[model samples]
Target: MTSPHRPASHGIPRPRVWAPLHYPGFATLFIGYSVSSLGNGMSAVAVAWLAIELAHGHGAGLLIGEAVAAYTLPGVLVALGASRVLKCLDPRLIILVDAIFRAVSLALIAGLALTDTLSPILYVSLLGCSSLFGLLGIAGDLAATTELLPSELHVAANSLNSVTSFSASIGGPAVAGVLIAALGPGLVFAIDAATYVLLAGAVLASRRYQPPTPIVKSSSAGIRDGLRALWRFPALGAITLLCVIFYGLYGPVEVAVPLYVSSVLHASASVLGGYWTVFALGATLDALGATSIQRFGLWRMTIAAVAAWGVCLIPLGFTTSAVIGFIAMSVGGLVYGPFIPLKKTIIQRSAPGELLTQVAAASGVFTVSASPVGAALGGPLVAALGARATLAFSGLATVTTALVAVAVLLAYRRRTRKLSGDR
Candidate 1:
């Protein structure tokens, strides 16, 4: 396939921001991806609530913590093994199979919940099992997108992907909360299950998206190949490291925000939802403006995003007013949203397409690997220091990491230029 920046046709004008949708297959893929993301978002809320409910207020915190941990942490192990699966299987088949697996798992969980047989261990196990496929699905989905569209549209398309995720996240929790209030968490799981069916259908319909021929595998292709491939691309490797640290440090925000709301602001759950919604809104807005930011260098934009995230979190840490917190979170989200899409686009452009799935899977491992670590640290830090103080430290640490990144990136670029000159 031609590079993303290449002209669509000799005499044709450059494609606009929404150009990817014009490709019928990509449109189908986007629809499916969005639907699936919405379900994932709803599940994010439902699973934690179910865990707490199953706890019967006994060790509810630990139950919910385990459930959350189960939902994501298992994906790390799955990602480590996913490169082998992606290497041996059709990426399209991998995505479709994952959707099927998740749909069945959710349906079973919904049934179990309704039957009042869902134990906390059982619930966490089911979610964790389903998430095994989740990591593989993400790797396949990104590789599929990179294959379906020309490389030039990667940024716009990824921006659209981000918008779908952020929009779903904003809307999903609100809808799930209401549904849970009226019908309980079981029904929400059922609905989320239905959405996965929709995702599966979309994947099936995208059969027309034929990827370019994959690289011929040598006998040595194995689990370690993904990480090795990632390191081979210096720019992508650096960017991926930056993403890991940022998410690692930002992990505390997940724990700290809710604590801050409950402890400091003495706010209602609605206030917590409002904070998340505003942040999602900011991310949605940033996704919309991604086309405008395309003129800037990716590394520059990435650094700025990291810096802005740290700066924005300061107000969130210090603020006593919900209004100020909302504004701060919104701005933080705005700055943070672009970094992810930017990171993905950079990886897509820089990495070999044939290794894209493995590289992405490896990237996922690095990116989320820190969340559990941060959570482990965050619990203690919050206990020792107030949630507000914990947030400030997280923010400051992220900014410092970003500053270190600036130096590292600058040096890397200079060395690369010198090497090219020598050549």
Candidate 2:
């Protein structure tokens, strides 16, 4: 059996957190992905803002919702069909194709906007087209990470990815706000399109450094194979379930937090912004330092994080002070940061290499949907319980879910151990 802790280097001292970047191929991919993610973060704001600009008076809210949905919902469908459509392609090729498609679609949207010909309908349709391959792109990126770095560095690599995403979330919107005021959302979309072209070029340039592609037996069962893999692997299934619940529970925070700040605390938009900014900063810090907790075990770390996140949210539920709310959100972000990296690390380690992308896509289908469903449900929850109570309810429910998960997982582990002993 192979040990899991093999060093990236033979003898020279190197920081474990940055170990994955030492590889040239991964480093190139990281830089391109980082640049592109910043663009993505900007688009997250620009898309909705542009939707607001184009929407007519009576239908503005509906059109904005449609535009946002167009950007995200297609990725769920793409992830669902990935096993069938993407089974034969190299992960890197999938990434390349996805990037090119995004670049073209976003460029088209930009062109239409610049020419003043972009209708709301066309804008929504193009946004949908742009995201059709989004989930596959993410699956390919993670699959490529496994290929580019050793197993031990996966957590660090994933954490670095998380850090980039969090940082972009902070910086992208701020930049987009400024750019949209000066150059308009159309030009921002053009900049975003350019970033995807750069990503495509990076993918092309990294070809020489990538190891020879491994042959995977093609599957016709579509996502069922990935689902079956989850059922067949106990650990994978458990972690996926935990993630679904965890994310689902967090969705209400998105809906409730702003409401809480406004209705309960009587605060301004700037206060809400400040609360989230602090949260993102804490999350970024935690993600940057994720490698330090590797020895404590990913499973324990995930569970602990979930529980701590719940505890953090409890404070917000009871507090009327903006300062207390900010502190709670900051701590919540710290605990929440490790959840994604840890989940990806476990999935990458547990799944067979050939099935990795499919497994990830399959997992994405559930995890991606979880939050939206929770957010949709949050409307009724907030109505019934009010914002402060809703926050408390989400936290309490999340803690209970984590406790139940722990008991179930422990029982399953003991049973597996006993069965192994008998065999």
Candidate 3:
């Protein structure tokens, strides 16, 4: 097998944005993942709208919160188990299994909705079931990217993945609004389910072009090994903690934004979809442009992005105009676009190759849980403070978190410099 890190000498100069697609294996996976991401993006809108329809009476906010949380929280447990049960499996197999299981679970939900037998309990339960492998799938995809490209291209590969999802966001919600209006959210979900099947096929096809290395069996230390790796790399631990805080703060927006559009703006689903579509449009544009600014350093880029995102979101809290909300979301998306790729790049560079999957999974356990936990809290916050106030509060708190991170990062740099002088 050729060295995964060996750069291909294809004398042809490709645009930086399209560089990653030059590799066959990564290209194949990227194409499949991009198609599936459109479905996921549609489901993002459909799932919340469906929950709102099912929720009734005073407890609606809490129920909506539970329904949204259900989609991702279950993955926390599955991710924990991955360290033990999934460590020996090939990354491509992990991706395939997740795609298959999610497809089936979502198909069941769609079927129940179409049959008029979908209760809130069943809907939430099935949503939870659909995401059981969510974290593992993410870890697998990252691991597979590492195997498919050299280290130098990993950042670009990660950016491409983010760009694909954001691009789907641009089209998916707009299309979903039309679909939901015409055929209802159930059909939209069915479409998403079909996309997963395509993703499974993509993973299978990639194996034919470039087979992944077999994972050697290791001592069954489980999540402990992953935790040890995090401990050994303080930077990873710090980055993971920042992600947990940042995502947790952002979670309330998931609950608040929908309510704000529905109740505050008194807008239809299309308007709500419009907000997301605009946000995604900005994100996609910024992500494509990110390669140009990477020389600034990932840590600096990440901090600045978070601070700017919080600032952008503050405008939404004060404005009731859908136009204003759209503007805020669009700016927010630009600031938020670089975050995932930058975070993933840091993890990829920081982690040991042997423990990449475990470290990703372990870090994922916290980062993944953060948003859901915040969403669960969002219900009560929205109920008590109103959606507008909740949006403002989340923004303020996120800004504070960024400031704390900045201070911590500066102090750490100073300490490191002092230690080097002593040495």
Q: Provide TM-scores for the models.
A: 0.92, 0.95, 0.86
lDDT of each residue in 1-423, candidate 1, tens digit only: 113333221232334779899987779878988988888888889998998899997999888888888877787797776555777866666788788878888888999999999887789888887777777787777777787888667778888998999999988887888999998999989988888898888877877664444555746554466688667767667877888888888878888999999999999988998888888899988975665675666667878899889988877677788888988898988988888777777777766666777777777788777777877878888888889998899889889988998898788768877987999
Put down candidate 3 lDDT per residue, 184-245, tens digits, no spaces. 88898899999999999999899888888767778766566777777888667888999999
Arranged by TM-score with the best first, the candidates are 2, 1, 3
* lDDT (C-alpha, whole model) for all candidates: 0.80, 0.84, 0.82
Whose lDDT is higher: candidate 1's or candidate 2's?
2
Clashing residue pairs, candidate 1?
4-151, 4-152, 5-152
Better of 1 and 3 by TM-score: 1
Q: Which residue runs of candidate 2 sit more than 4 Å off their true CA positions? A: 1-15
Q: What is the lDDT of residue 263 in candidate 3?
A: 95
TM-score, prediction 3: 0.86
| Model 3 lDDT-worst window of ten | 1-10
Model 2, 1-423: lDDT tens digits are: 011222212222334888898998889888889999999989988998899889856688888889988888898887776666667777777788889988999999999998889999899999999999888888888889988887778888999999999999899999999999998899989999999999998887777777548757674665777888788877778888888998898888889998998999998999998988888888988986567775667777778889989989988888899989888889888988888787787888777777888878888888888998888888888989999999998899889988987888688768877987999
Rank candidates, lDDT, best first.
2, 3, 1
User: Which 10 successive residues of model 2 have the least lDDT summed?
Assistant: 1-10
